[model samples]
Target: MTSDDVRHRREAGHFVRWALAQKIARDLSFPAVRWNGPSQAMDDEARWATARRLLHDDTLKSEDR
Candidate 1:
């Protein structure tokens, strides 16, 4: 694989990890104004499901920035 491919993968991984953290933070309602809409509990498997789907989806690649 090329270096660019490796870099892209790394970026994607970072994105997934960041997303999971954000979800956890939000679920905890740390901030006073965060959306409290029918919040779902975040588990390892659920987070992994998000990452798995994200890694396979290129449609959102350009939206990260």
Candidate 2:
């Protein structure tokens, strides 16, 4: 693989890890907050699922990039 490819992969991994950590922190900090109609619990579940999927996939995409 090219250097750029490796770098991108590394960055993607970092982003996924960061996202997973954030979800975990939020999950641990407090019960799902209900704001308006949507709840934090639903958001957390989606984030967790996305993070898991990204980690399993060979190629990672980061929105921050």
The true-versus-predicted C-alpha distance at residue 32 of model 1, in Å, is 9.8
Q: Model 1, 1-65: lDDT tens per residue?
A: 12544545545555556766878434321122245654777799988987887877677765651
Instruction: Output the number of the lDDT-best candidate.
Output: 1
Query: Which lDDT tens digits does candidate 2 get at residues 1-65?
Result: 23544545545555556766878434322223234854545677887887787777656566521
Candidate 1: the clashing residue pairs are none
Model 1 collision count? 0
| Candidate 2 positional error at 12, Å | 0.1
Clashing residue pairs found in predicted model 2: none
Best by TM-score: 1
Ten contiguous residues minimizing lDDT sum, candidate 1: 25-34
Backbone clash count, each prediction separately: 0, 0
Give the C-alpha miss distance for residue 5 in model 1, angstroms: 39
Structural similarity to truth (TM-score) of each candidate: 0.32, 0.26
